[model samples]
Target: MPVPVVSVAQMRQWEQASWSAGRTEAAVIARVGACLAAWLRRHVPHNDRILILAGKGHNGDDARAALPHLQGRAVDLVEVRDPETALPDLERALARGPDWILDGLFGIGLNRPLAEPWCRLIERINQARSRIVSVDVPSGLDADTGRPWGATLRATCTLTLAAPKQGLLHPAAHTFTGRLEVIPDIGLVPCPIQSELCWTLPEDFLDWPPPRPVAAHKGTFGHLAIVAGSTGYHGAAVLAARAAQRARPGLITLITPASVYAVVASQLQAVMVHPWSAAHPLPGRYTALLFGPGLAAADLPAEIPATLARLWQEANVPIVVDASALDHVPRGPIPRDALRVLTPHPGEAARLLGTTTNEVQSNRVAAVRALSGQFGGAWIVLKGYQTLIGRQHGPIFVNPSGNPDLAQGGSGDVLAGYLAGLCAQPPLQGDPERLIRYAVWQHGAAADALSRRHPAWVVEDLVRTLGRVAPHRVASTARPATPTTPP
Candidate 1:
């Protein structure tokens, strides 16, 4: 299930509401402090020296309150205001060389740039070799945009209170915030937002395929059709088909240019290869259609649009658009009955929106939202650092599982094929949104798993590692209900 993500303003509203409902500011502060203290005890060793940097705000109050809970540690508290006056004590604490520095300088509501004293203090903190643990958000980061103000504190771990801030999920926030954890018992409630940004977790895969009943057979899982590849890019088709097969799709049919059919066919034994031509029609019984990978616009026939439209209207199945196929997407609003997903990199997204890649990367949230609206209601998977999955009416989900290792050729093809294969499964065929999300998560998870074993892994390694992370556990009869957003 997806977790809720809120802005600083929305978080303030929730805090205000909590206060209005009789939860005092001190109580909230104490609750947050206690949670932070508990986490520190569990993760940090008792023998390690601790330095708590408190500033003037509720964040300071939270830090002050947490001091009592960390009784056993050799702790030093510095209430910083003017850097000139606080420097001596701060230097003294630093000279002691604490293992951890708890930064409670600013919370989520900081909008303005940091002044002289705070800037100096943040710089000193960053210069230190100690591991910094930030409370709520990093000191100089914009909780809304994920942009740093002046000298931002790069925290080793950020223990965010309640829900995750929107900025924390941004691509730029990765280095500033290393390992992010949410403390749910900090008296914070969900804000009234239609869509949220959520972190994808491993447990979310519990019911991926659900339990395969004893009566299930090869035909029960459903079939996938992949329309991809060209003369020079036959590897894309092979990678996509191989990935789809790894996802345990019941059957997979590859529709590629006749020039590359033999090459693609030689690479896979499980996938049925078909040489595509104007005379050969697509399979009518496919559960989903994954269009694009290495297919170029020049390689397509003049009736490509009509052929895609006919298949969409006739089959009424999920369609995943990716790679060069994205160049040929219809300009008008998408069909109301069609379940479509567009997987585009920044460049492809820019091409689709008639904008620059720089513009799209600068504001990913707005770009994806605009793309979703442009399609009337298609799911847009904007691929990048923090890959965003957005639906017309649903919240944008940030995939947190992938790493820089996925920044290689054929990764997108694998992702597209994996999504299509998941959609082809019996339990996920009807729930295209969930299937897409799961595929994105699994794709990243596989890469993450491979990254640990090998410093660098190729596309083929990722395809092979998919089975390791694929859910084989049979969920109990009374499985947790799939989480839903409030209407």
Candidate 2:
């Protein structure tokens, strides 16, 4: 089963369910300790002294249980509880200067700001030279909001139990939950419980198009329409279309206004560029559609909405509404037959959900689901660091791949095209959810692969990397010759 990103409440229920399933507290604790100790044995050097700032709560118990595994190693347990009493031991631990600290003061249970002495302790840990491994979560951090209370521990690694906590996946929490590692075998099975948020994996791609048949041609893949660009934002159109081409779409038509036609048309090679004319009517031949990449006031005329409405009523093809186009997506519960995917950045998502961008970023998992409920669509990719993809009334899956290097302007455009290109394809034609998720994952993975070699890159660089990142999709078969004009 896919891993679920649980909240504090759900996590409690999960533990309760596990206990009800006949798991004793001691058994669970022993399993958790063994896992942590095994991980420590592999990573923590034998020579380094270990300091355990054990608390009295669940997190603290989780830390002390692992003490048996580190039997021979130099280990100290400072049972830190009340601010007044723990201060002396806290100072002593800092003075002793253990090389590795196991942070187990608080995890998901913490919501409010840390008290004065507790704040000082976290600050001291942050200043400490020792590398830290936090249990469950980083102390002084709100596991749900990913916001720091007063001072949050800066861990070198965080050993999260079962599935990852929702707040730990938040971009803001990255500094605190450094290099998240999931301890899967914790004597708990995550079944019979559902969470609104989930962590996406590379395996989510679900291998595509079993090495094409010899007779497979251009149309065998699929065709995608990208209604994008404006006078100032022509590059977005080119980027989206080319990125779709990387998804190995049989054909992609960049339908743009006449004013920005020359710039977009000149840049695209395999993807066809059609100068959009209000008099000519919206093209309806493609398998999938991508709208709103660089649209401005000039692009969203009365016809834009009318045409979208018309297509919504008549066409069965999946449409990927992105950027400015996200504003006009079907509101409330979407029609049963409609299959529209909205890809919006925080600002665009905020605009659609009628909330502030700060509110959306503060809890991205909620914002993505709210997008699905408020602006109904088959899927909503709330693009950001650890970009979230939400299925309407379903789990909000967070992409684990990608680095800050993809924090550029045209990245979403590339993602939209990548999704559309795959959506148009033959494999998993009716069920595009996996393909859509794959497209999102591949986009991040490509950026991750690129960031390792180059310090900086642009959206244009992604199309080329897509082939190297997943050659099975882009280079599995000989691509049909560049597409001809749409009828």
Candidate 3:
């Protein structure tokens, strides 16, 4: 299913277009209301009392419209009004007993913090035992950014209108929204509008890396080189190499300080190691290279640019710069036409872009694009709750998988390694853009798999989990001389 995520402003424009084309709001609402009633009847059954917390908005109208069709079932309506007009049915529901609450108090257009009466009522609704269901977005959530305005109602489910709102999947909005479902108001006008909630599932990355031939050799999978770890951070390097190996790379190379090479080598049986020193230069045959992840920030100014330049000049390898490596290169005009990928958290992204974390969070699409463009159109993965993937154009995707349990150290290292391995595959080629898109989807999928079976997920687990997780498989046996366009 194509998950169309749109903003409040776009939704309004779509509705206006529909209205201009002669479709009435009441008619659209009636058809949607009937669907809601049918779904409610199937899910909640008859005789169950439903308490709808209705605001003065159209969302309120949607809840009110459903009341008549409920038929003989007990309905409790809580009207939140200022200069009150009378809706007798609403009055009856307000006076009724414990029931399921439908929170239609506010839509995504609400920019200000919630005011009195409504705030108090939200508190009451929270305390009630009834399961709360939001109509569009949870009232207090900022439609564009997912931050709560003041207090927001926690809903068991949110029946969002037309399409999924970007705010619903925001990390900050997790408290309010539950399982989000989009119901298309199909009778309404269809505008040529794109939604903000663009996400990729395991199925979406199907064409990536292609498949291997039966007679493939070790070098066929692609040679992966990882430059990571200091004395204390060997775990970071180990996790990255292991993750790459798990992703089925043909060969693996680890470049690190001499102090920890033996330990890293022993810990990782499959990956080869090279000591990172002034004496040794990186090999020219590597298919992909991953730098950073425990690299000392103090050494970045001298070594990073030199290393990046060498990687670019020596081999046409797709490179991934992550963790401390981002410190190596700050946000500025980068050399053109390089195969690079940058994975940064909001704080790191802010530092690179010369802005505050707040600025990065405010408009993630802009930040992602800026970083990508400044650095030769490198793939940018802005890691957060709704991880935004960037291209030179804008945010190409916002991943909605994984869980809070994944909030641990070394996860980024695992991701860096995951991308490196994917880059090495024969089918994936040296396309940094495609690598970022597919790697992020697979990384989140692995985390999602881990979360289902356990608690307190670790990054090392991600390294081990990759082989168990399947990549999208296609039937074409011929390794096309040219890159296949993403389906």
Candidate 4:
């Protein structure tokens, strides 16, 4: 199961409760130190030179406690505010050029800006060539907001204690909190039972692509219908269809505007393409529908609203809405029985909410929840840094796998089509929420994998890399594990 992300205040509350329950502060600090030291010994080589920057508070106490276990190495420990010889000690340590620097300075509770000497020290740390391991939250970073308090230490890895801080999951903090590791069981217990946010890890997808029968044919997998593309944006439809193909849907039929039909048809040999028309009824046999992506509002037929209404009301299949299709959502409340998923970036979400992008980005959780409620139990994927997936009456799923490489155009279209394809698969049918989550995971996982080879990757690269990922298969009769927390 994924772990909960708590704010600094919540963490403090938990710490106080633990202390009242007989775990003393000193004892907690000792355990954290021991665990951190053990983790370091296991991951870091014993021969590497180490420098420990200790502050005056419990963060420093934790680092001090670890000294006993980190013996036999050239380790230098400097207390930030020590009056006698702190500066000389720091200078000498810097001169030695330690292989690793363990930053135990101000932690999550810090809210104020850094002072002169501390600021200088942080600047030096940032300039250093040594790898940095930050204990708990990195110094000079707001653990609640993921914003830097001034000059913050950029860590090679952050050893977060107990639960992950809510701020660390913020997209802006990814560079500073490189490769987050949550240290479990450091005297903090009885974790908050419910939280608005939870982070997704790779381990959560260990049982993906649930097994299929050997005797099954293409028809057994299921088919999907994609309504996307316009005159100039034919590439959008091609990307979506190609990504859907990579996801292994049984069959894909694309309904596109006549202006772009020939180009899209020529590019895609496997997918069946049909020119969209209001004169004819939409094909109704597919198990899932993916709407939007490259469609132009000006070019939509006069009867499109009625056409969409009919498909949504009578088709009784999962519909994934994105891009231009989102512009046409009925202004009134959606039907309670509708099975729909809306994949919108902040701008599109803001348009649906009649608000600004700033408002949507500022309070993404509330925006997604409001969308779900207003749509009468619809599922929503608010795509951005830490892409969020939420359904009516369900907690948000925070995706932690994507990077800046996915910030380009047409990425959301690929995500929408990929999700639609997953929904069309037999194993994912009737579970719109899980289907969306798994698709989001796969989308980011592929981007993450491709980023290691190239500095920048286009949407097509993501489509091609999807096939290289190894799918975990289970017994045909097996079911996906129910997440402990709300999924």
TM-score for every candidate vs. truth? 0.81, 0.75, 0.72, 0.80
lDDT of 1 by residue, 321-395 (tens): 889887766645665667788999999999999999999988888888888887767889999876888865667
Which candidate model has the greater lDDT, 2 or 4? Answer: 4
What digit string (tens of lDDT, one per residue) describes model 2 on residues 181-218?
66654677555567776776544444643477689898
| Residue-level lDDT for 334 in candidate 4 | 55
Expressed as tens digits, the lDDT of each residue in 1-487 for candidate 3 is 2345777777788889888999888776666556556546655747778886677877777776666666677776667664134334444554565467877778877989876655665676677777777887877778778888778888877877766777787657777787555555436776557754465544455655566788989878888888888778888888888788877888988888777778887887777887776555564677778888778634433564577656644455677888877866544444455567889999999998899999998778888888877776777889977688877774377665556666889888888888878877766664555566677767776787787678666777777776465643211111212211211
- Name every residue pair that clashes in candidate 4: none
Candidate 1: the clashing residue pairs are: none
lDDT values of the candidates? 0.78, 0.75, 0.71, 0.78
Candidate 2's clash total is 0
Ranking by TM-score: 1, 4, 2, 3
What is the alpha-carbon lDDT of model 2 when measured against the actual structure?
0.75
Q: lDDT (0-100) at residue 239 of candidate 1? A: 94
